[model samples]
Target: MDFQTDKASLKIIRNKKLEYELPFLWIRDNCSCNDCRIQETKEKRFMLNSIPADLKPKKISINEDALNVIWPDEHETIIRFQDLELLKKSRKPEKILWTNDFIPNNYDWSDFLTDDCVAIDAFSEFIAKGAICISNSPCILNSLEDLAPRLGPIREVLFERIHNVSVDGHIYNIAHTSLEVPPHNDFASYSWPPSVQALHMLENECDGGKSMIVDGYKVLSDLKNDHPEFFKILTTFSVPFREFDEENETFANEPIIRLNSSNEIIGLRYSNQLMQMIDPSKKNLDTFYKAYHELCKRVNDKKYKSTFRLEAGNILLVSAHRVLHGREEFKPSGKRHLQDAYYELDNIENNLVLYKELRGN
Candidate 1:
C-alpha cells in the first residue's frame, strides 16, 4: 500500500487497483483516540471546528497493517487498514427483486419468536426479499404486539397505534369497507412514511379477500430501464396525498419515488386512494400524467402481483418502503378482521446483526 497527499486530501492506493481519496479534515475529525472519543460508548468527542482548518500531518508512517500519523501538536492518530477495508463493504444484504412467481418464505411463529438462529434466517430473508410470512401466530386481538421484540416498537400514527381493518370497524379509510383496494403503502400522506409494516390476520373466514403484494422496487427498476423519462419524472414530480377521519387528519405532497445521495432508490410513496386532486394548471401536468398512467398500469398488472390467502393465524410482514400491499373485495359473508402496525426497518436490520454476532455466525 502507498499514499500520496496534496493540499486538500490524501490518496491511498493498494495493489495498483483500489484507491481512496480522503480529506485531511475528515481523517482528523474521525480520530478514535482515547482523548478524541468516549472510551465507554465509543462516541465522538473531538470537534472539527476546534482544529485548524488547514491541519496537516507532521510525519506519516505505514506499518504492516496500519497508518500512523503525527500532527503538528504532537498528537498521534493510527488508522487500521482493516477498518478501511471494512468501511468499503456493504452493510446490508443485497436486495433480491421478485415478480409474480415469488412466494414469500414462511417461518413458524414459535421459532421466529423464540430462537435467535431462526430470527437471523427469517430477518435475512426479510431484508433481501422485502417481505416474509409467519404462520401459527395467535389469533386473539392485539396479538400483533407480540412482534415488538423482533420488529421493535410500534410507530403510532394519527388514527391509532394498532389499526383494525374490518367492515364493522372505524370507517376512516377504504380498508374499513369491503372494497377492492389498490396496491399501496399506508400513510403515504406522511412525508416520511413508516419503513416496515406487519399485517396480522386475526380472522379471515370471508371469501375473495385475497391479499395482493407488488414489489414497487422491481416495477421501478423495469421502468427505469425501459422508460427512463418516466422514471425521472416520478422521482421528481410531487403529488398530494391525504388520509383522515372525523377527528384526525394527515397530509403531504411528496414525490412518488425517493433516492439517496448516491442516487439509489431508497423509498417509494404510492397511494392511489389517498391521492388528492392536483391543480389543473400545474407545470408539466401533461407529462406527469403520462408517467403516472404508465406507473399505475404496471403496478396493477397481474404479471407483477402475487395473490394469496392470508389465514387467521398468519402475519404478512413487509418493507413498506419497497413493497405495496392491497386486497381484493370480499363478500361480507363471514367475519374478516386484520390488525396492522408500523415499525422502522432500522430496528429489524440492527436486530439481525446483533443476533448473528451473538451467535458467532
Candidate 2:
C-alpha cells in the first residue's frame, strides 16, 4: 500500500495489507461532514458517544488525488493527502505524547503576570514545552484593567476567548465550595483534549488548602519500573466516568485514562467522584489497585509535594495532563479566591512566537 499527498487531496493506493490493517471505525471517525466540524454550533451536530461501531461504510473510492468515503448514514467526505500530512505533523508521537519535551527547563516565568503585560524572553520556551509556573507579586486578576498593556498582545496570539468571572459565578462557587478536591487530572475525560490551564490566584486567607501537584509522567515511570504488569492492566482498561448536573440535566461518561496504539499513557482521567467501579474480571485488579493507591500516596506525600499559598496577587499555570492538582482542606471560615482561564496548547505557542518576534528574544 502507498499513501501520497497532493494539493487539496490525498491518494491511497490500496493493497491487501491496507484492507487488513485499516478499520472502518477509523474512517468513520475521521469524517469531515458539517456535523463533525469542531466549529459547528448546532446541538444535534455534536458528536455522540452512542455512534454504532459495527456500522460499515457504504462505499470507499479513490480518485486521482483523494480518498472519498461514504458512510451508511449517507455522510460523504473527502480526505486530501496534504490535509492528511498536516494532521500527521500535528499528531505527537506516542512515546512523547504526554511529555513536555519541547519546553525548555531553564525558561523564566517572572513576567507572566503583570499589570502592564510584557512578553518575557522565556515565554515561548515555556509554552512549547507544556506548562510554566509564573511567580509575581500583586494579583493578575485584580489588575485586569491594566492587563492589556502587558498581556494584551500575548492574549491576541494565545487565547480563543478571555473573560472574567464575578464572585457569584458558578465556577467561583465550585472553587469555594470544595476545599479538598480528590486526586484527578484536568479535562482528561473530554474526547477533544484540553491542552493548557492557567490559574492566577487573587486571594488566599484560609488556613489550609495549599496547592498540590503530582507529575503523572513520574508516576507512570515508577509503575513501569516496579510493576510493569500492573501498569499494563491500568493502561489497558478504561474506567468509566459520570458527571451529573441536576439543574441542566447534563451527564457525561468517559474513561478515566486512555492509551494510544502502543499502550503508552497518553491521558489521565482521575476524577474520584466521577469514576464508576471497574469491571471485576479484569486481570491484575488487586495488584493494579495496590499500585494505584501507592502512586496516590506518593503524590500526596509531603516530600514529593510543592506547597504554596496563593497570596493576594500570584499566578500559576500548569499542563493539565502532566500535573494532577488539588488543594488541602481549609478552614470553613476563611476566604480563598482564584481566577482561572483555559487555553489550547497551540494558542500558548502562538503567544510565545509573537512575544519572541516583538521582543527579539
Candidate 3:
C-alpha cells in the first residue's frame, strides 16, 4: 500500500475487519495524549470497566486517500497506510484530544443540584454564561447535602478531581484562615487541566477576603501586544509547582503554563509560593522578572479584576484555565464556611447532555 498526504482520502483494503471514512476532527478529538490517560498509581488506562462493551467500535473505514477515519463514536483515528500489512491485524486504535474550548455557554446547574443540595438557578445561569456573582441567599449553601446524589459521583463530573484535598480537617469549611493563597490557575499543576471549579459560600463575615479573578487569556494577549519578546520567552520557558503534606508527605512539580501543538494557551500555573524560579542560564533573571511582573501587574489591574464577596448560598463556577482566582488577606478570627468541588469540562458536558436528554430541551 502507498501513503500520501496530498490526497483527501485513501483506500484501505478490508482484510477481516470492517472499515469506513472518519473525519480528521474525529482523530484530533480522540488523540491519546499522556494527559488524556490515567497516570495515578502506575496505571495509564482510564477505568473503562464501566464502559459498555456494545459502545466499543468493532471496525473502522477510511475513504481512499483519506487522512483519517471517523469512528462510530463520532471520534476519528489517523492512519499511516505505509504499513498496510500491519492493518490486517485487530481493530485500529483511536486517540483522544483534551481541550478547554469545549466549555458550554448554557450550563444548567439544576441538573447537578437538588433540594437536598443548594440549587441556585440564578448562579447556574451565571456559570453557563461564564460570569461571576455573589449571593447571601439562604437557598445556596443548604443544598450541599443533596449535591452528592444530584451530581451523581463527583468523579463522573471532574475527571481529575483530587480526592485528598485537605480543607483544614473539616468536611465543608467555607472559610479557612487568612493563609494567603498564591495567585495561580486552579489545577494548573495537574497534568490534566480542571474543567470547572465550584466554590459555594456558606458564610462570610470576615473582611478583606474579596475573591479575585483575572482573565488569563486577556493577560497573555496584552503581553503579546506590548512585549512580544518577553511573551516568547515566557512561553518557551517552563515554571514549576509543589504541593507538600507533612502527614501524607508528598510533593509534585510541573510548568506553570503550557502551550499545545497549535501554540494555543492550554495550561496555567500561577501559585507564587509553590513555584520555583526559572532557570537563569536559559533566560536572564532580570528580563524574566520584568515579564513576570508585567503579567502580574495586568492581573492586578482594576479593569481586569472581577471582585466579589461569596456571600451565603452563592456558588461560583469558573473556567480554571481562563480565569485566575485568589483571596485578599482577612482577619484570623470569625468563621468562613463553604463547600467546594472540582470538575472536569468533560464530566460537566456529559451531565449537560444527560440534562438535555432528560428534559428533551
Highest-TM-score candidate: 1
Better of 1 and 2 by TM-score: 1
Best-first order by TM-score: 1, 3, 2
Error of 3 at 9 (Å): 4.9
List where candidate 1 sits over 4 angstroms from the true fold.
15-18
lDDT of 1 by residue, 1-361 (tens): 8888899777777787547777888878878899999999999999999888999988887766987788899988888878888887676789999999988999999999999888999999999999999999999988888899988998888988889999998888888999999999999999989999999999999989999999999999999999999999999989999998889999999999999999889998999999999988889989999999999999999999998999999999999999999999999899999999999999999998888889896
lDDT string for model 3 (1-361, tens) is 2222212333233553334343333334344445434655544453344334334332444444434544465544454544444556533112112122322232334533443122333234433444444343344433533444433344322222333222344331122346555445554445554555666676666666776666666667667889987777677566655444443322335544567898876555565655655566755667767777887777666666656565556666665766676666777455566555665545443554455446664
Residue by residue across 196-296, what tens digits does model 2's lDDT show?
A: 55566676776777766555665666667887766666665555554434343212344434578887665665666555676799676687687667666
Candidate lDDT (C-alpha), each: 0.91, 0.53, 0.51
Model 1 Cα shift for residue 355 (angstroms): 1.8
The TM-score obtained by model 1 is 0.97
Residue 290 in candidate 1, Cα distance off native in Å: 0.3
TM-score of 2: 0.55
